[model samples]
Target chain A: MNIAVLGAGNIAWHLSKALIHAGHPVKQIWNRTSEKAVALALEIGADSISTLNQIDTDIDLIIIAVSDEAIESVAKDLQLLPHQLLVHTSGSTALDVLLTYTQKAGVIYPLQTFSKAVQVDFSQIPIGIEAFDEGSTQALFNLAKTLSTKTYYINSQQRLVLHAAAVFACNFTNHFYSIAQELIQQSGLDFNLIRPLIQETAAKVQQVLPQEAQTGPAKRNDQLTIQKHLDLLKTNPAWKLLYEQISQDIVKMYSKDTSSLK
Target chain B: MNIAVLGAGNIAWHLSKALIHAGHPVKQIWNRTSEKAVALALEIGADSISTLNQIDTDIDLIIIAVSDEAIESVAKDLQLLPHQLLVHTSGSTALDVLLTYTQKAGVIYPLQTFSKAVQVDFSQIPIGIEAFDEGSTQALFNLAKTLSTKTYYINSQQRLVLHAAAVFACNFTNHFYSIAQELIQQSGLDFNLIRPLIQETAAKVQQVLPQEAQTGPAKRNDQLTIQKHLDLLKTNPAWKLLYEQISQDIVKMYSKDTSSLK
Candidate 1:
């Protein structure tokens, strides 16, 4: 497969390399900042193009891995033939943006955070694939399979819901880590102390249901310890609110009958 | 050191097995329910007692692994001598709870969630230690050192704060997992799809600050995606509230200058 990448962000940087490693030639790399494009392209052995028009006509796939808001603008700038499939690597984005410029539009959201310095194992990462037509869907599944063993045919609405869930699973969970870090630091304890607990909490979910993996005062419905935690968070009123409210939700979850499960 | 465990709960069950595995002869196991005490004690090669009064005074250390609310009650029942030390494995309950019963009061709180079915590596777990006096402190440290290489001399107040912080890092984080699981399940997508993302979110914090590891629309101040998520979560008003407020806090965190840090 001949691929062209649009953007120099974390996803673009990593996905371009993974494509080349998987024996798919990344034919072109383009970014608003030509210097970044050139740097990434040189590292991945792809040609850096200053403009989308410079992309070769024979490129089979075009992957736009820019910010969610930038997806539409990047799609508008690109020109593709019927044989070329254009896809955005965003869970929150839909297929219509790319379909506006080309009949062949699709998405391959990696559903994982990326950093320029970190080399992630592509084979283990889950990819969500959606496309406008049967051919595009087949092409994307083929491309995604090269990078991952886990791929799902998620539609536009489902992908949006996945993004929302991803925030709770990743972004908001990291926020809890930050809150925990602050609480630990305020008491003159190292944040590293909670690392193993934090590691195991998430690891447990890999094997069990999050409901089954749940523990602590909230899960036990221990009101005394719950009150104690609320009292301790009095200085941080916002965190106290989260502690109280989330704890209440957990209590309700486990306390309720299983007949009402969603 | 000879040890006596005063409860047969999750922590008590695992800690007893871990103690026996560490070559400490658990002198006795007691619970309000003699059957449970007998069941656990038999598993770990220890005698089970119907009443805490039957605990051997020759035992060097007494461990009360009851619920936070029951810590005081269990401490009151235990029979000890001047040479015997008593400790409660609770993060929220102050050392004073045990002090009311004996001067050899201390705390050896294992800062991890445990299940009787799963065997955790005590060597890697962090144990928080606190005691009523210098001698008890040294003794508690000695005992904690045997269980883990990572033991901190935390005081009663710090232990409360640690418990509070732990609820954030572990309890609240797992609650987020439950919320995410529901969201994914509602969309007919498997919860397993988000496991890798959850694993990486926590694992990243082990090596870096949570602030540095933070990502998503909130970190980027991508208002469009944030609004989209909020709109999607309107069916679950509580989750919508969490998604909105937590994202706002995250936006403030990364946007603020260094001078305002806590």
Candidate 2:
């Protein structure tokens, strides 16, 4: 399958390589910054296109792996072929972002975070696909199947919901790490010590629900320990407030039936 | 090594088995509850002692895997003979918890969170060891090395710091999962959809630093996405407050400059 990737971001960088690895012919790549596009294209052995008009109409699929806000604008600019499939890898943006511009538009959202420096195993990554019609959806699903073992034909609304959930799980959780780092630094300890625990924390979720698996001062409703942690975070109002807020949230959610400060 | 486990909690249950699997003899087991002690002792093929006075002086090590508040009280009840090494599994409690009653006291803290139902591979888990003296410390280190491939000779101070950090990375991050679950539920999506992502999110930190591996709306400072998430979470005030607070914290910490949001 000949593919045209129209973004040079982390998602594009990884996706292009993944496509190549899966034995797909990446016909062309394009980015606002021609250097990045050219660099990625060179790595994937694909032709680099500086303009949307330069994309080959004969390509089997065109995947716009740009930012959420840029999807509509990029789709409006790209002169898509009559029968060629056009898909964007934005989780939040509806498939209609593509559908409103092209007859054969879809979403090919890789449901994993990507970093150019980090070589992720796409086999483990789940790709959420959506298309304007069942035929196009099947095509996107088939394309996704080649790249990843886990492929789901999720609708635009479901994709948005999943993306929002990703924000909470991925984005919010990383913020917790950042806050933990700050607190550890303030306590005069190396942040490296928490690495194992952090890794295990997520690993545990596979075997147990987060609510049932939850532990520590907050879950146990140990006010003394919570107060101790709160006092420790006194220097950073942001962190103190966050600690207070999350603790309350935890108490309200998990330990509601049990004894709690709230 | 003849090991005596002195608690019947989650940590003790896993640790004793790990020690036994590592080719050590679990000589005796004791707990506040005689039945629990007997049960655990029978499971591990060790002697069950109801009272501390019944403890055998033949064991090479007596491991106190009790609670922080109960450690000192339990230690006072136990009478250790000379040259018998003693250690507590409490992360926050100092090694000195055993110092009052015994001459040779140390700490052997497993940096992984344990639940009764889930069995952890001790080979991958990092154990933080602390002892009052050099000789005792070496003994604790050797014992920990037998149980786990990753053992750190961390002092009491470092253990406390690590414990606090674990609460942040493990406990607080679990709360983040709760938040994600809550938000996804509010969005009318199944929580299971986010479970795989939740597991993968924590798994990523093992390979990359939290800061470098950070992603999502907050990391990008995507105000539109943040506001949209806030809007989605508005029905749930507690979650809304959490989302706002964490998003703000992420922006303040990771954003290029702190000029705005000031």
True contacts kept of each: 0.77, 0.64
lDDT of 1 by residue, B66-118 (tens): 88888887777666788998888998988888777898788888999887656
Cα lDDT of candidate 2 equals 0.79
Tens-digit lDDT track for model 2 on A1-262?
A: 6889999998999898988998989989999999998899899899998899987767878889888788888989977778788888887777766767777888888888777776678887888878888898888888889987888767777777678778877887876776677656766766666777787788777766788788887776777667766665677787778778777877777666565645
Native-referenced DockQ of model 2:
0.54
TM-score per candidate, chains pooled: 0.97, 0.90
Q: How much is B231 displaced in model 2, in angstroms?
A: 1.3
Which CAPRI level is candidate 2? Answer: medium
Model 1 misplaced stretches (Cα beyond 4 Å): A258-262, B257-262
> Could you tell me the fnat of model 1?
0.77
lDDT (tens digit, per residue) of candidate 2 on B204-241 = 77676677778998888888777766776677787788
- lDDT of each residue in A1-262, candidate 1, tens digit only: 7889999999999888888888998989999999999999999988999988888988989989889998898888776777888899998888887877887889998988787755678888899999999998998999899989999999999999989998998999999889888888998998878999999898888888888888899888899988888888898888888888898889888888353675
Every prediction: chain A TM-score: 0.95, 0.95
